[model samples]
Target: MKKQLFISIAAFGILLSTGCTKLNETVLDESSAGGLTDKQAAESMIVPVYATLPNLFTHTNYFALNEISTDEAILPYRGGTDWGDNGIYIAMHTHNYTSTDPNLRNTWNLIFQGISRSLTAITTLPGINDASAKTFLAEARAMRAYYSMLTLDMFGLIFVKEDPTALSEIKRGSEAYDYILNEFLAAEPDLSSDVTHGRMSKQAVWGLLARLYLNAAVYKNLYAGQFTFAGEDMDKVIEYCDKVINSGRYELSPEYFAIFNDNNDTNKEIVFAVDQRADLNGHNRMAYFSLSGDQFPLPEFVGANGTDGPAITPDYYRTWENAYAPEDPKVDPRFYKENLSIYSNANDTCVPAANFYINRGILRGQQYGLIRRNGVFLKCANGNMLVGKLFHDTRNRPTLPVDFTEKVDFSVEGSNYPSGYRVEKYEFSRKSASGRNFGEANIVIVRLADIYLMRAEAKLRKSGDAAGALADVNLVRASRTARTPAPPALSNMDLDLLFRERGFELYWEMLRRSDMIRFGKYEGTWTEKTDANPQKRIFPIPQTAIDAASNLPGYLVQNPGY
Candidate 1:
């Protein structure tokens, strides 16, 4: 396994200021000029490109921009004090963010860091004449394309940098769309056919192409009142999705939660993922981000607790409830998975098992966990664990129950630690039993189920083939046969139903914002957000980036309505 790459801030600043120039050889930890072979040098150049993914997808950065800004999640102040980072979370949920928002700025910098590192590899890897170097070059190009696509999606612009010493030509609108599409197309053929875990592969490129084409209409005209999904674009989406589906290399996991489990590195559903194997700079924040501080999943590590971050919005929860009305949504295998087997009763207490698992899916109502007293976990008379109803333990509200309410208030005073329903989609890392950063669960970027949904959406959009779309949606719903009474196949399919189905399968996965925009539902009011401005569809260019490029006037302009 490759060790995590560490680049210093000064070195990164030089690369950024120099317009994505080739890094100093010593920056890659070279002791001597001729110390490494061609293949080793090429590998070294590419590692940093992949290293940027974990930070880019950190819960507070890109994930926040994608989910919190949409109806899927919300992060509010706890007791009008905690998480009140100058109202940034509230501004993001309510669509009042500016270029100066810290989350936006961090996401912008992380995306460009990936882009810059890819450029360094693309420019420097060619020096190695070995055949293996060619494959690395293709992967570098694909990484650059992926970062560029994110740039277009978030900031409505792409930086086209070819010469390391020269200024980057900024592309926007159709120009940016074509550039990103061509980059992926150019790199697809040379990508390794064999699955390389964290690295980009041929199937990963197919998945990325399908995603790009599905959102082509939006990228072509970002600020449009309503995006016009073209038949050709939808055809491209179906074409690429068919390539992945027909390859016989991937499948839907029977246990829905297993797809996000700590041992999911080998799971067939994942196409492209940020490999967070042991020893890499993996973070467990995704697992504990939405969890209440009082609810500790791992008994061995009492110190490893939740930060009481974002929670699922009631509007999103209602979608699940309304879909399976009369029957509880939890009955659907994808909706919820109860993993705490030992603590079955409200007054249950037993020796905490080493393999304790937390409940997955939309968490609601009262929560139960190991009791902590006087900064120590309580134990039974037989030295077993004592499990009971939890209370607020971190935010100076110990008397308040840790019951997650469905409806969350937008105002600071109205919001509390347990205001909204929490989601535990990803499993907590056993390796990081003592901290939040040593997780080992791969952050899935593309997966087979999402491919099926993309194909289903394309089929519905292209010709309104309800049967074709229904078959695809049912395939995903029915594949989760591990739980009793799998999600029943729907007899009907439409745009509205397809949109809701996507949410059912792919919520809290950082796809909600783009999904809402593509389905023409972004401007609709949901929970605290009431802004209908189309210009808010894409975020503004970070003011810091704009100022850095001030020397070159008109080089980096902010998106409209900043």
Candidate 2:
């Protein structure tokens, strides 16, 4: 089932790059899709619904809006030229973004595109009489719920339509939240329990339900003082998480990095993921985005310059540093401590002379990597890759020692560009012949580790089961300790401790914004952000969407803050 979706993604990417998707074209040819056999029609109808996923989860879309907006990452203008698209990134981090931000507008449109496609499938797929027809219908509805939930979570509104030509009504707050929850519930019965991880299976539905229930209070009231996790909601979260856990289909990955590798489809830890492939339409942006122009990861490909876009915040980095003993920071397996060295030969075969190949987790301190000079890679006397000091893209800037630091000077113009550390959470693809342009790494959307964490959190919040919560947390910690030294186990648990534990386990996974809001820290001042307006809890509906919806009477409403 997943292979079929992968094939669709490959075909979709080719057509998408050529500007031939129905969302871009003049019209949808229902005859071609409708005239197919039952099996063929089912596949055709589901393509559009899955097609919008790449645009939604790609580096610049959902990941940028969610992670960069939080303290986990930031995309400052390197050398005051690159990544300086009218300060949109800064606006996101600072919470000053308006409805006119182009990136924000793009995300808004892409999400609706998914919702629109899903709605089309819900009405079209039910007409087939094949055995797969019911499963396809349920999957379509589940897709709609998934997309709608994201729209609601981010914009505080969802669009509802009865059929392809029907009008859409804007649902808000608890109304929109409840509608999405019920949609998932309605689809659960018919959803295939044994579908591939990438498809909408009963497990995926349960994971989505657990997530929705976990954040029920926040969705019920957009901005509230001290959210109360309703007992029933918390219980539901536990129940659904248990359902996923007890299924025995997933287990904690012994290697933390294995969960995000290119071969992660067979890792057995991922419950839901975006099936990206190098030969198909996979992305190298996640691992390549933050690297400097001088660093090269692959020996087979050249001229692969990273965008130097997003970097980890010092505040988040301090959390990891402060948790462990300073003498040996790499003792914790999640930190990827063994390979890092303050010095490098620069002539080594590794992409980054610093030996960052296949390494995962946060990066800090002096970085060693091959430096590009005079439009060619600098080489050592023995024909080994020479280590040259990195300099700003701007001419005559001070030479960089490849030293990554925690503090970044976001306001410096053209200088101090390489001050922040780069994230290597996703495995760098050494097999791609296209270098950083394409990759084969599968991006895990949800995994067993997350399910365990959610259940542990629910147990702690619903009942004072600190011991039970600690056991779950330890399970995750122990699973990753097979190759690296394990941290001492905690005797007790608290909300603050649990929150920090989540930072260690789930950073850079696009969960920071929601987590911060649930923890009541979203409004608090951090780094570049201020004004903490309660109205900023949910982004303003894009002005473009609002203007387009104005064609129909009372069809759309802008969010509270623009």
Model 1 lowest lDDT segment of ten: 17-26
Error of 2 at 328 (Å): 4.5
How many steric clashes does model 2 contain?
A: 4
**Winner by TM-score:** 1
lDDT of 2 at 171: 88
Residue 418, model 2: lDDT of 72
Candidate 1 lDDT for residue 195: 50
- Compose the digit string of candidate 1's lDDT tens values, residues 1-562: 1111223222443332221112212224333223455555565666677778877778889899999999998888877777889989989988899989999999999898899888877877776656777888999999999999999998888989888777789898899999999999999889887854577889999999999999999999987877788999999999999999998899899999999988788899999988776655466478888888888777777776777889888889999899888888998988899876543554455645574667898888888877777788887787767777789866667889998888786665447787888898988888763655456788889999999999999999899989999999999999999988889989999999999999999998999999999999999898888999989889888899989988987777778898
Taking the tens digit of each residue's C-alpha lDDT, what string does model 2 give over 1-562?
Answer: 4344334334434334421222111222333433345665566656567667666777888888889888788878776667888988888888888999887888988888888777767776666657777887888899899999999889988888876677777788899988999999999999877756767789989999999999999999987878988989989999999999999899887777778776676788888776665543566367777776555665445665566768888777777878775645467777763342324444344334334453356666665555565666766666655544455542345455556667764668322567687777776676666668665676777789899999998998998789999999888888885675666677788777888888888888889889888888888776666667877778878888888878776778777767
- Every candidate's lDDT: 0.82, 0.74
Each model's Cα RMSD: 4.4, 5.0
